[model samples]
Target: MQFLAALLLQADGTDLTRPDLTINYIIIGVLLVVAAVLSVIVVRRRMQERDDDWE
Candidate 1:
């Protein structure tokens, strides 16, 4: 029972430490940048296609 309680407490504790948090933030930032770039490319391509349709 005590072991189970201790295990539960440990599991409930925040997993993010200083370095881990920083790395996580960096990964998220990179992903956001990639997504933004991809979206821009897709939008530009779509716009170009629309323009071509008019011609």
Candidate 2:
């Protein structure tokens, strides 16, 4: 994974550790959190709707 990240950074010719990229990192973090919350909600709803006999 580290190698892949380094390769991508080299391809883009930009360092992600720069201060200017902070907003981009923040946006990505927020999107990931939102996706995780949505996924958990969908999974719990689906589980609740299933027949209890399977458990």
Candidate 3:
């Protein structure tokens, strides 16, 4: 994957040089996944606490 990234960076045309927009899109996607995973963890913890309170 690192080799592919370097190879892609060296390749020609607008696809490689003007990649800021593409990078932003990829960053946003990664952030969204992180947020989703964190939300799942928070919800599971809350549910567990609620169950403990009921007991």
Candidate 4:
């Protein structure tokens, strides 16, 4: 989490006038997005496993 936080904040110290700023935003956006995706995957897998045990 802290690593993500640092990555998220990494842009704050940089000047947006550079082209890399745009790329950084894209990377951070992707990271945040994948976090949601992975969380959903985990919950779904856990539920499926639990359901299978009930049989």
Candidate 5:
């Protein structure tokens, strides 16, 4: 399994020079930002609910 993985990686030449690498990075970054925003919204909403329960 390891041998086949290594063979595949070698067949691709260098890692950084791949044209699609930048697009992949951009996609990952956008996903992270969206996740963070959603997380913040959920936490804030939960906090509001908790505060209201204390009234």
Candidate 6:
């Protein structure tokens, strides 16, 4: 039981402890920004095409 407690408290080779999540959050944020940019680009392209067709 004590060994299990220690394992949970300590970082092992397999991340047996509370893992640092700063990098994960940053990666997620970056991916979200990229997705937003891509979506905006797609919308702008479609709008430009539509405008050209209308005019």
Please tell me which predicted candidate would have the highest TM-score against the true structure.
Answer: 1
The CA lDDT of each predicted structure is 0.89, 0.86, 0.88, 0.89, 0.92, 0.90
Task: State, as a TM-score between 0 and 1, how close model 3 is to the true structure.
Answer: 0.64
What is the TM-score of each predicted model, taking all chains together? 0.67, 0.58, 0.64, 0.55, 0.66, 0.67
For model 1 the local lDDT of residue 1 reads: 100
**lDDT by residue for model 4 (16-42), tens:** 454557888899999999999999999
* Candidate 3 segments whose C-alpha is farther than 4 A from its true place: 1-20
Error of 6 at 9 (Å): 12
lDDT of each residue in 16-49, candidate 5, tens digit only: 3656688888999999999999999999999999
Residue pairs with colliding backbones in model 4 are none
Using lDDT as the measure, the top candidate is 5
Deviating ranges (above 4 Å) for candidate 6: 1-16
What tens digits encode model 1's per-residue C-alpha lDDT throughout 5-52? 888877887763435477888999999999999999999999999999
- What 10-residue stretch in candidate 3 is worst by lDDT? 11-20
Model 3 lDDT tens row, 1-55? 9999878777745464453588888999999999999999999999999999999
Better of 4 and 5 by TM-score: 5
Where in model 5 is the C-alpha error above 4 Å?
1-19
What's the residue-level lDDT of 52 in candidate 1? 100
RMSD of each: 3.6, 10.5, 9.1, 12.8, 6.0, 5.4
lDDT for predicted candidate 6 compared with the true structure:
0.90
lDDT of 2 at 46: 85
Better of 1 and 6 by TM-score: 1
After superposition of all CA atoms, the RMSD between model 2 and the true structure is: 10.5
Lowest lDDT block of 10, candidate 1: 13-22
Backbone clash total, candidate 6: 0
- Model 3 clash pairs are none
